[model samples]
Target chain A: MIERTATIASTVGLHARPASIFAEAAGAIDAEVTIARAGDPVDEAVDADSMLALMSLGVEHGEVVVLRTGDDTAGEALDALVTILETNHDA
Target chain B: MHSFVGVGVFRGRVIGPVRHMPPALAEPPVGERLEGSTAPETAAAALKSAGATVKELLQERASRAEGAGKEVLEATALMATDPMLIKAAIKLVNTGTSAERAIWEAGEAVADTLKGLGGYMAERSHDVLDVRSRIVAVLRGVPAPEIPDFAEPFILVAEDLAPADTATLDPSKVIALVTAGGGPQSHTAIIARNLGLPAVVAAAGVTGIADGTQVFVDGATGVVSTDPGAAEHAAVAEWQEKASLLSVFDGSGRLADGTLIPLLANVGGAKDAQEAAAANAQGVGLLRTEFCFLGNSTEPGHADQVAAYKGVFDAFPGKKVVVRTLDAGADKPLPFLTDATEPNPALGVRGYRTDLTTPGVLARQLAAIADAAASSSAEVWVMAPMVSTAAEAADFAALCTAAGLRVPGVMVEVPSAALTARHILDHVEFASLGTNDLTQYAMAADRQLGPLAALNDPWQPAVLALVQATVEGAVSQVKHSASLETTSPKPVGVCGEAAADPALAVVLAGLGVSTLSMTQRALPAVAAVLRTVTLPQARALADRAVAAASAAEARELVRAGLPALAELGL
Candidate 1:
């Protein structure tokens, strides 16, 4: 498992458009991905490709969410996802 | 030939075969009766079928129902399965009647019983009408009996039409409409005039003519004839051609006598602003800001508010956009507004009154409008809704001004505001009358309820009395402030349904209203109406309107009063 911490950078946080975008990107990769807010017990786990699951988490801008991925290409997926979140997907 | 006349809601002269709507689609047949005496089993199946039909109908109309309509539908669905209707159906089945016949008889009996119970049944009937119409339309395989198509521009005739049914018209193609079963203030009539289609509602015997019969209809005269003589047809055609030519706007909102009346557009959102700009409207007269709060549980934050405001402001760069601050309350409830509960919400804390209870919400909204104005070149003017007294107007003005926003106006939607307009103008830059609400309040009529609909007359002397009071207050304010040159004259504007109405527009302009703001779709027709009369002529029309007995009479009087201008335009 590869784990990393990323800060939300989308202007609208994780509510509408940004949440959908992040979920789409996560789901494209073949890995089991889980996200949790820092120090929060509740974690959202999915196949890394479901937009609905990501939106249901209600992640917002400036919040630090921890991500964990487990798969053959877990390292590459983790690095790419962290970079996207950090840049807010250039939104 | 049997002819039924209703109101023509949309413009279009169509000639099509009469297609009655179908009954509701039945669900898969419940198992057949096992024997000759299976009353209970048959009753159960019929009840199940009715339940399924009601559920499907409710789901179909869920998105289309407005706030009150939604609640009414849910209540109606519950009533559909009420014990009374079921019991009646069972009794009929036990007597050896067929399932469909039993259900129909039970429905009629229940309808009659509930009619005596009053409002609930009336509302349920409306739902039933809606459901029945849909089922009928489905059965007939017609596109909901929309405006028909004729080779030549002609008159459309119908028995009755839903607002949704009326909305499906191509205004450019339709000339006029005559209906058999709608009152003057019916949604069909309102929508007809809004679309610039001359329509006569409640015209009895409109549908008596056979299909494909040539008909001559004078929408202005409420006259219709089947297979009119050649001369009559020629005259009608000539009049329509002349009217079409005269409805053109010359970019400058001026009459032949050169009286400049700024024609503005009433917009609901950013898209409407763009449409207004495209249509060459002078500017926005009323930019309703309530859409931002729709479908939400909490008041929009400052940023969200700013973004929405900015969208409108940006759409009309360098043009005036008057933003009415969140004019929400009982009539338009927001899920986030918890304290808005009231039996008579229309008369309750709404518009500016609701703001007083939640000052923070108002402040945030005002601040966002200010911030949006600062960011865009669009000139933004802020207004408040439902200011009944001068003090409320003054306080609202102070808040907007303090926030660096140009507080151009307050809407006089209440009769009290019209009565106290002079005092209210003391605090604000200008005022606009929301005639729809003012007329409702002045006549003590619930505008939403259909039976009290007669009292919703815009031309009732009582309503004109309020308008007269508002105009008098405005004139007095202008005169008193004339000496102070720094203080610009408080120009009152009419920014309501009344303003969009071409006939009413003349009356309003004559009543000392400097600007008329109406729906963007109405700007052209209103502009056409403005070009037909001078300020003096408009005033004369207003006088006639004030003296008229009914709205129809008032409309006729205004049209008659503007004969010369009307001749020039039409």
Candidate 2:
């Protein structure tokens, strides 16, 4: 398990286009990934492929979310996903 | 058949064989069903197969158009993958139906879905229409139909036009369009105006006319004459020539006696700001800040807000940009404003009212506007919406002034504000009548309810009475303050649907509206109307409009008062 904190750079946070883009990128990696807000239980596992599920979490800007990935390319996947989340996509 | 009329949106005459858009494309070939297969199972399999074929066809088209028509193809691909349509098909199929039947049923179900989603669905519908058209063409095993050629320019009649149908139409060859369905703000109406084609929408029986029939569309009168006599044809030709002449003047707006009125554009975002500048709008009259709040989950920070304001300010260079702070509430619900509960949202705690309930939100927004204005040469005037009382106006003005923002104004939208305009003007630096809301409030009618639409008419005497009061208050303020050396006259402007109406523009200008702020597309036409009448003539038109019993009568009275101006072709 690896832990990292990143601010939501997308203007609209985890919703609609941004969430869809992040979910698509997360699904491409061969890893069992989970994301949660700080202090929230890890049991609330969200499939990174579902935009609706990601948006249901209501993750907002500057809120820290924990990302745990268990796979050979977990580090690469986590880095790429975090980078995408921290940048505006709708533009 | 009973006849109904609508304002013509495009111009051209088409006489040709009628070609109705073919129904849903034939379903993809399905594998033979096993004997005694359950209806549900067979339906599911067939639907799955149909979906796969649609997906495959879209992918192939996209790949083929990758370099030359990538944007168009990509939009079609989105339609092909629309979850709503796919879900509707699945639901229908699961209830037991052939794939072809299910697809057709789904298409019918989603046809009205676009109407409920506003701008987002309007855009999506364009793509869906494209996909449907392509599928129909494929099913027919024919190339996409060529633009229909007419021996002479004739009217193009249709039941209703999807945006895609209008997209491929050639404006030059199309003289006029008449439709049985569509409203003033419908996609077809907007597209017709953009193409400079005369059109009349919601004219019943327009599509029922056989092909090669002679039709005369009078856009201004919203009348369609089928198989018109020679006299009518000659009159329409003369009107068309006048309309062509009116299209020439577009630079600055001036009244008949040469009184200059600044014609500005109302923009909602950065893209709109750019378009306004490109279209020669003197400046942005109303830059709505609600969009930034409505689309995001959290309040935009000072830096974020400032950046957005700066973008618009920079775009106009040296021109004035009036930015209205977040008017979100009831009518436009922001996701982050969870506590903004109202039984009647339109008349609820919104505009400046929200500022009192949500601490720091308005302050932060004001700070951002101030900071942005400080960096730009363009003047930034900040305003608030939904203000009904003098106290609210004073409070907002004081807050903005304390934050070092210049020109804090209040939108005179509520009837109370217009009725007591004198009190409100004493506190704010300027005022802009949001006529749409004021009309709704004055007439005690819900503007959105189609049934009460007649009562909610902006031209109603009651509505214009409130507008007159607001203007009188502004005039009184100017009179009282004109003698004071420290303060300049506070100019009153209008930013609403009424401001864009060419006929109403004359009335508003006559009623002492110093500025007219409207959509970019409407500026040129409104400016032309302004140039045709002097200030006194405009005032007389407004007076007559206020005395008229109905919108139609008011319009006619104003038209009769300005014969030369009418010839300018509004």
What are the per-residue Cα lDDT tens digits for candidate 1 across A1-28? Answer: 6778889897546533455456556757
TM-score of chain A of each: 0.79, 0.87
lDDT of 2 at B120: 30
Estimate how well candidate 2 is docked, as a DockQ score.
0.15
Those runs of model 1 whose alpha carbons end farther than 4 Å from true positions after fitting are A1-91, B1-182, B194-198, B205-218, B224-240, B243-247, B297-304, B329-331, B338-341, B356-359, B448-455, B478-483, B547-557, B564-570
TM-score of chain A of 1: 0.79
Q: Model 1 fnat?
A: 0.00
Best by DockQ: 2
As a whole number from 0 to 100, the lDDT of residue B380 in candidate 2 is 88
